[model samples]
Target chain A: MKAYLKKYGIRLLIVVFLVVGILAVGRSVRDGGAGLLSNVSGAIRTPFQKVATAVVSRMEELYGYVYKYDNLVQENERLRAQLADLENQIRANDQAMEENARLRELLNLQQKHTDYTFESAKVVSWNASNWDSSFTISKGSDSGLEKGDSVVTEYGVLVGTITEVGTSWSTVETVVDLDTNIGVLVGNEQVSGILEGDYTLMRSQYMKLSFVAETGQIITGDIVITSGAGGAYPQGLILGTVSSVHTEAAGQVEYAVVEPFTKLDELTQIFVIKDYQVVE
Target chain B: MFADVIDFKKLRLALVYILCLAVMMFFQDTVFARLGLFGVKMLFIPAACVAVSLFEGGFRGGLFGLLAGLLCDLSFPESTFLFTLLFPAIGFISGLAAEFWISHSFTAYMATAGFALLVTALCQMVRVIIVEPGSALTCLLTALVQTLWSLPMAAVSYTVIKRISRWGNKR
Candidate 1:
């Protein structure tokens, strides 16, 4: 047994060491030995660490100064951008106020012509997803809003029709949706067209003047308005501007891309045309 | 040659272990990230501890493992306090085995390797229980894989330490 033990003594010693080492290391790690080591090492190496730290810090300060200079330059650029944006917003607001004054005058003119009642509604929220481009208004069923009610801005410009009615909220599906189709006429020219939405392109829809003869005198920038032919909307409501005019190869039809005057995203306030009795 | 009379073998072994621990701690993250196989990282410190234990006596070997593990935990970013306690416990257990039970044969080396693997796996299991109680499946799988992977390294370290110890005895 002694001879066998002698032969294996070294191996046995190693096994003993392995177990002890794991325990010591584990204990030290648990009890914040690292912080203690760092403190000790720091005390021993302070002069060198400090000198190195100072040199590095100075270099960092120089780099920081450079960064600050660049930051100031960027800040100046940002301020200039904000100034330009503010100027644009101010110009837009002024134009809107002037348009409002003009619309008020038009409202008075409209009152002389039609006995329709109007209720003002403020746009509160928009659908967050593109799958539904509908917007909600603060006025709803309580505000005499019902499905199929014609919605327009203060200037008698048709925006959309109220599709869904709730107690305190209503949804307006703009004419740009695929499901919407309104009979329209070119202002004063009396040229009739069927305004239908194109779902493929989200932004704009097609206003096809299918029966307009090829020789029909349609020009660019012509104003399109609701024809009041289908009794869905009041007559003479502004629709959009004629952006393009194309004659079919067969020479019997003409179509135009009418860019709406009012951006759908920017719509804030609108009126419901309440007293227009449907001619059904 | 006369300077060898002071028997700097123990000191040299201690220094080597210290150096190895430092290197392992410093590069632990890089090593672990690069060398993970089947989602298991090799526990290099435990293998080193086993090696040191087999080469040096139990006390020094266990001390080396404890220091190595402590250094590793210190260097790690998301380290917890439990590592310090657990690692040293593993070292003590392994070192006790090395001191009392190890034999000088091929079978002895294999036994040492198996013991080292078991010690490491046990430490890791305890850590998992404390840190993530419900993930027993993941903990067991990782611990098993790491233990297996550590075996070869333990063998190599054990061999190297044995050679050095023999060289020390010759002087």
Candidate 2:
């Protein structure tokens, strides 16, 4: 028995591993849920990821400053001149009109949604896979986050939805992830449609708004926002502007490409909406 | 004398390899994740696996492949079965091929590494292809670009592992 074990042990182990791999693949495809291995590894790696992200971010900032020093000097001089001109224009337009309007808008939004609960999280690491657009955040269920919670920018632009949460870290599937689907209203007509990530569009950091009626009047540069129909996402969260409109080959279907307001690549901090009253 | 009997050189080599793998994982997860060309990210782990396997032989290669595969799966947002299954197979086959037919040369390593990379790229897109048939062409193009972009990682792996292997030989 000992001799037999020595002879075929490698083969037996290979079989076992293949079985495990197959099962894992099946589970991943079936539900897209994290397994025990994922949870344990995530718990172990979260701290390291946080440190690495911080170090890399600092290094990038330093590198940018060093590399762009000369360019920045020249640009700074140009910008100073431009700033003086803009300041003159601003004084001429006077009443502090732009600042007043911005403050009023902020006040209106604050007064309108008095029930929003915000929890801030820093992005620790991006998903290493080329196939998906998601990132891990430093906050998780420990911070009162849950799967399906909406994430947004500080200015109330929709970023994504939390899909997987570990004890201390959560994965945010961004607005451009292939699996993300959100109901959106477009243009002044408020034409309703389902906005989803498309494989081709995602590479360009864009999403597709489909199911619009053939008669729907969504043109280029139209504002798109969350419809808040099903209470899944908050109403009036800025999605993006329409980049271009497209029609199906048969002309029976229409879709518009939306360039999201919050650039996914530039995000460092995000706010998760822990709870919100359904605004309809 | 005790160290020689226990082959301390091998032990030291293993430790160094582990350290190297960890550093590579760190860079792959953080630095490489942010830097991409034409929307294709570099895959360092697989290239490192192939490099180590070619020098270390089948048994060790397979083991390292398994560890690297697990890390790759864990690190990605959408975990796939492809890396866990394919990586070890690539390691084992590359090891055997190196032992029997191929020389430990840059050209040979690149050829084998390219094959491993192409397989990974194709396998990654199989689900996307099945679910979104219309996007098949775009996925294929992306996969090709990823494979091309990842070749420099293979070159780096070769240089690093070659130096390590030479040190082991000298000792």
Candidate 3:
């Protein structure tokens, strides 16, 4: 028995370890909490990720400068030509006025939600999984950022929510992630539905507003906002605009595709709403 | 006393390999994470594990795989142990294959890496399929695309690990 055990002990141990790992992972998933190992791993990787993010940003800037020099020159010449035209001044002034108004609207985001407390964080690194849409941010529990904090743009566009938190880092699961589901009201009629991240729509950076009643009036370009039905999310957070509506093959149910106002790929900084008055 | 118990040569090789692993992970999380191809991102760590396992034998390879998988799980959002369990097994099997059946060649490495990637993709798909049953076809397609895209990592990992292994073998 000892001889046989010696020969196959490593393999037996591997099997036992795998079984234990499976059970532990299942429990962790059920509890929705990461264990100590994950936290330690996050701690170890955060500094490296920060450094890498800084280096990548610098490299991108350098690459942009080197590659876009000719485009910049062409743009400069066109701008100079436009400076000589009378129509250009009026168009430029109009654009400037629109931009000023937009800036004011963005600034009002803070005033608009006086009950909400905000903490800003920079993206350190994105998740490497092709199946997930999440990124690690610079602040975590150390900054009083909790697991369910809603992340948003300065213009009050819903980005996502914090899914996991470490001491100094947290993972923000973007709205396009397959696991995201937020209660949303669609259109000016405010047809209530669940904004769910669909696997097919996620590829195109869109989500599905499912569970809509067939009689609901939802048209293309209709704005969608948080319904705040269960008080999990804050009310009136602008999620996106309805891009399209569809019906099930059974023709009994309807859904809509929403394109988010926030350009997720362009986000470098975002704000976390740690505490918000959830008005239903 | 510690030197008597541990081979300094192997320790040097292990440290260098860890450094290489860190660099690969850095690039995987930072650069490859953003470079989407047909809606799926590239994953290189599984292939890297295969390459290291092929050269390093079972014990070291399995240890490296465990480390790599832990890091991968850390980088994945809300993922606890998917890679942590899969990668060590991949490393052990690949190492055993290398010791008994396969040659330490690029073709052999690619074959093992391809199998490892397919297994990894399938495991990832299982969760999606369970949660979003309506998107089974989408998940399958994504799994295939992810596997195809990550195949190139085999060549990269093989070239890098082979050179490092050769360097470590020198007296």
Best candidate (score: TM-score): 3
* Better candidate by TM-score, 1 or 3: 3
lDDT of 3 by residue, A1-280 (tens): 9889877997899999998998687776869766666679999999999999999999999999989998999999998887778587788798678656655655698788899888878888778786778888999999999998999887889999999999999999999989999998888788888999888788778998888856678889999999888887889999999998886697644788899999887787788989988675
Candidates 1 and 2 compared: the better one by lDDT is: 2
Q: TM-score of chain A, model 2?
A: 0.60
TM-score of chain A of each: 0.58, 0.60, 0.61
Question: What class would a CAPRI assessor give candidate 3's docking?
Answer: acceptable
lDDT of 2 by residue, B100-127 (tens): 9999889999998988888888888887
Ranking by lDDT: 3, 2, 1
Model 3, B1-171: lDDT tens digits are 897999999899999999999999988888888887796987878888888888888777888899999998888865689999999999999999999999988898998899899899989888877888998888888888888888876689889998898899884
Q: What is residue B124's positional error in candidate 2, in angstroms?
A: 1.2
Better of 1 and 2 by TM-score: 2
The clash tally of candidate 1 reads 37
Residues forming the 10-long window of minimal summed lDDT in candidate 2 chain B: B77-86
Candidate 2 lDDT, A7-84, residue by residue in tens? 799789999999899877879786988767778999999999999999999999999999999899999999999999
lDDT of 2 at A85: 97
**Ranking of predictions according to TM-score:** 3, 2, 1
Kindly report which residue stretches of model 1 are placed more than 4 angstroms away from their true locations once superposed.
Answer: A1-106, A204-215, A277-280, B1-171
Provide fnat values for all models in the order shown: 0.00, 0.69, 0.76
Q: After superposition, how far is residue B143 of candidate 1 from its true place, in Å?
A: 46
Residue A270: error of model 3 in Å?
Answer: 0.9
